[model samples]
Target chain A: MKTITNKKNILYSKKELGQIQLLLPVILVVTVFSLAPLLRGIYLGFTDYRLGDPISFNGIENYKQLFSDEYFWNSFKIGMVWTFVVTAIQVSLGLGLALLLNSKVRFTSFYTILILIPWATPPIIRGILWRQMYEPNTGAVNILLTNLGLISAPINWLSSFEFVIPAVIVAGVWGEISKAAIFLLAGLQTIPNDLYEASKIDGAGLWDQFRHITIPVLKPVLAAIISLTFMWNFNTFGIIWVLTQGGPGGLTRLPMLAAYEEGFKYGYIGYAAAIGNVMVIILSLMLFMYIRVQLRERTES
Target chain B: MKRNIYIVLILLVGTILFFLLTRKNNNHQNIPLRFVSLAWQEGTIATNKSIVNEWNAAHPDIQVEYIQGTWNSAHDYLITAFETGDVPDIFHYESSVIIDYAMRGYLTDLSPYISSEMKNDILDVAWATVTRPNGEVDGIPFLIESLVVLYNKSLFKKEGIIPPTIEYPWTWDDLQSAARKMTKDTNGDGVIDQYGAGLGLRNSANIIMNTSISFGGSFFKKEGNHFVVKVNDEEKKLLQTIVDMLYKDKSVSPASIGETGAGMIPGLFSGRYAMLVGIGSWGRQQLVENAPKEFQWGVMPPIKAKTQTYGASTQTLSIPKKSKRAKEAMMFIDFMLSSKNTARLALNDWMIPARISCLSMPEFKDKIGGWDITCSAVSTLSIGSWLGAPGYVEWKSRVANPVLQELFAGRMSIDDAARRIEHESNIVLSRYKKRGEVW
Candidate 1:
């Protein structure tokens, strides 16, 4: 009777205790691998730490310098343009493709696998491939553009100040849209056919069905992708590094690239950490507000 | 139960055999040392491995393990190894790139390991490359390279231009005119079909900084017994000449400014480029290998302005500070740099050996691939002012490279480039200065 009472306790139960035990390993792994490094990075932000040099606590000295750093501000401004532009394109196009795949169409599964090809490719490889295509002399882009009579002379896409950002954005959108589409497709599958059927019975048309049923059902997945991809895009380094090396000039030098240059190339580990900390604070505040808005809408609905 | 017993018996036997094998193999009490060699080319890799094998066979008591490393990943690997206290016993790298590591006390000072004969045999220019301002000899330079102009023999003949010899190399003015004289539109297209010269300015920072020595343009200068970042019109001379060749004369292509030396090879062989200036000496070896059988090429001696000289960018071998068997590792380095062995390595790598005795090797006298010219230019090599300077790497990559690139590309005016380079370089230097404490 005592064992049964223990299992039946409202505050704590044996079954619930067993579930928590199953999660202990996962919790430990996350704490050790992810949480510890993040916390250490934040702590290092307050110290003057260069590679192979002694570390000392310098309070907000790095941050004070960061405020006046023209390079840092330039990177942040470019990163904003890159992250928001890539996220907006990835989500909107992804939803359209997700809707097309969710309907009862032939070869839906085959097309779903095809949609995952870009996502399956690694970011560095994608950068290299896109770089080759953007090469001036013998690139496929130049060849295609020539055939279409768009321009006479070949333009060096990656080396030009005018065309580099849009060119890199196109490459970023290509590599990331598949991931967004796959997640939204999963959400689309959960929307029952009966919801659309009930909407059609209420004299709803196609856009009406989408506006009333599909939009609300896909909101959660959109919110997740929006905030998550915004963060991921802002922190992107490898692809852009391989693509332009933030160049023609520093036109595409994202904040992550600037931090990497400082930490690895310039050996200012503390300064890099400070940049990362500032980025995290801004991202976290935005994410908090987004989640709160999401929750409020869920309750109102 | 019977199957379980069989498995236990097999496991017991395996454990006993493993211990017996290890115990038997531990008979030789050899002190192991690791040599991290960054030799990537096919010929150089073979030579390096063979040298290590010879060292291992000749000294059974001191076993030196050969760990292959790549040029691309060497910097990151060494930094991590030093920070984690897993330093290799010996390593090979360039002199300038290791200045930071030496300054941070990761390198063992090799002054004690040097023999008078060995010290006297190598050129002072090479030794000066690895010597710090405080006279700490952190490494031993074994090979040296200088800038050379690789030109097409056929085009020089076709244009009736006298190919510059080592005794009378082209002056900067001569090179500019020769470029203009050779540039032509063979196909009658409005676009120039054959560019006269390719500068290979992709690494223009190192090339220009070194070449600037001929014009007496030292990026750093002495003030009150200390070095400060100083850029003026003297420093702008070489870049301005190259820019004029690019934009004013229209003899060199803007593409050459973007392309590396290796990338210019295709243009050189295809008759699209007549001369490639400011390329390393190793480029001649690559040209010999890739050029068509009938296409003849010759390397002009180092070009001149006020004087004929190039930066003594030398490759070095250093031991880690924390190595237990530093003496043994230094012995291996010493043996590897013997006159005969050094000649063999330099011959295969197409680099000039730093040891003066190694220059007399019969292979260097061969006219093929302009060996005679390259060996003759050895006298012109000098120690660069930027050697072992703090924050030099940052300034080179950030200020000098982009400034030259834009100047050659006709994007930025010379004044703006110079002003930005001076302003930005001082900012980079000021961080490494002795403030209240070490930063």
Candidate 2:
């Protein structure tokens, strides 16, 4: 077979040639557009490439700087905390809401639309609106709480180091819960109804049914949703930039924000590229695990 | 033979027609000049559109292409344009980045293009902003908004505290004492219903630097070839007072109030605070439109410690060096910053005219409220060359601000905060030091 394929004249069929022709555009696009820029970015990671300035190969200088930089490490810690907390909260809230909406309920459509309002709002707008609500004085949150006699003074939500991360997490959950719910709801609808009915008749309470029939049936979907939401929350930059600017002493400075500060504010393009390369490696590992699980689950099924 | 002759004839005719069309198109169309300006606010967007439209109508040979930009992404946007060689003919930028852009050889020197008379027309402080250390005039100042203390007159009267005035500006002692006295429990709820003052202490590096300057302190001293951090006793004293006001006195608005776009304006407008310490003339229009009609306000120079001082940002118009339409952009800049046009813009009462001659216009004097006091505050405007020092923004955001916030939060002593700022700033500034440069 190898000998036979080695001959150029072996392609004696027009149909095979037509299939190869049809795939050329996609191959060309990937090569020229996607792969080229990725390779160039990787090259930039090792250079001193300030924008509009002369660039030269620096031989790991950027990464060397990254290793010793206190701010970079702080940003990594903050990004991990932000991503983990936001993803956990969003997934839990999304699962709960998906189950609720999946049940018999009146005005299901109305509830769906209402829940989507936060998701429909742009991230920057959500950041601004939430920042306004978190205003120390004259904000809706403060005014409402004051009126309810919950506290004697308005809380400093965004500027207190202790409260800034939690406040941003609240905004993050508010903006992202609807997206998770919608995705999980779609997955939930795909599960067979007979499984739940069968479980109920077999002396299973609601909790038992959820633990056995619901969770087992929806495991793959849940995994996929969680992974996707994890990536989304991990890569979030606009909301934090708009709301806090990674401030109140850099409490909310995610890796992305730190990268922007290094590249744009400090004009350290090479250092920024090194940080981005690290993020890409982390995200790639996550995606690799997700893909492995997907393949394994498919083979098992 | 007949087919070949027809094909040759057709090709010849097509080539002739294409050349004719190209020539006609090139001769008839105007040169396109792209201009980018701030569009993050409705007022600015409207103003930019109006000015562009007026300019286009008047200059038939030069068509203006307007691009709206936001402050959050403007730096990256402009820099990307430069890297890609697609720079705009003209762009509006904050004064902070003018030195950086000029140093990078992005901005065209305007001194050759500008007349001495035109240069002399602008305020000295405003002109100093665009003039680089190498004496290159790289930008034209279009607007200047001087910082001042804005106070609610009604609250002061009710508290039996005298309002600050230009002639009798509040001293640091008077400011604190008055602020303490004005803190009140209006509703008998056992809680202070009103804050005495609101100074933006969160993420306000400019305000802090200006405050330190006012207290007779300098953040950096010029050595033979580099800047050395010199913020010592005076700066610590200045920060201690602010921290005391926030944590001990509790007479000031919460530091968190400064973290939002609403800023202290909302607090002052809602009567939650009697005074706003570091607001500019830009906030004057907001107060006029949003403050209750019964709520009267006054403007005074910033509080004096050993000296009366504040910082000013002169929004600038610059022509990119790579712009094909540099001459046209200069023309547009001149037209925009002309005395009549500056005065007209000042009539909107949102910005003060950068042109000294425009400031003398009766329209600026009569049409704008608190215009005189805002202009008078310009004399006390101390231009900090250190603000434009290389790597200063990073030092401000990463080093100075975080340490200062710790002091304000009572997590660190004033001495420690000052020492940390000075040490970190020196480390950052060392990277930018040259052999013979001085501030």
lDDT of each: 0.84, 0.79
For candidate 1, what is the lDDT? 0.84
What would the DockQ be for model 1? Answer: 0.24
Q: Residue B424 in model 1: shift from native, Å?
A: 0.9
Candidate 2 lDDT by residue in tens digits, B1-439: 4455456556756876898787565333474688888744456667677888889999988888898878777888888888766788899886778777776778888888997778888888888877876678878887885677788888888888887767888898898888888888889978787888887767667677767788878786766556677767887788878777787898887743335324678778788888887766778877887778877888766788988876676888898888767888889878876787777666564677888887776656552367777776667886774755666666777887777777777778877777788777876776567312232
Q: Could you give the fnat of all candidates in order? A: 0.17, 0.55
- Estimate the TM-score for candidate 2: 0.87
Q: Model 1, range A136-186, lDDT digits (tens) per residue? A: 778899999999989676787876656889999999999999888999999
Point out where model 1 deviates above 4 Å. Answer: A1-12, A146-154, A195-213, A293-301, B1-31, B435-439
Q: Distance from true position, residue A43, model 2, in Å?
A: 2.1
Residue A67's lDDT in candidate 1: 93
Pairs of residues at least 3 apart in sequence or in different chains that clash in candidate 2: none
Model 2 C-alpha lDDT per residue in residues A1-301, reported as the tens digit of each score: 7778767657657776655655655675677689998888888899988765788998888888788788788998889898889999999999999999999899988999999999999999999999889977667988998999897777888888777888899999999899989988888899888988888788899999888777878787888888898899888998999988888778889999999888888777887888889888888897889879877986887
Chain A TM-score, each candidate:
0.91, 0.87
Report residue B146 deviation for candidate 2 (angstroms): 1.9
Inter-residue clash pairs, candidate 1: none
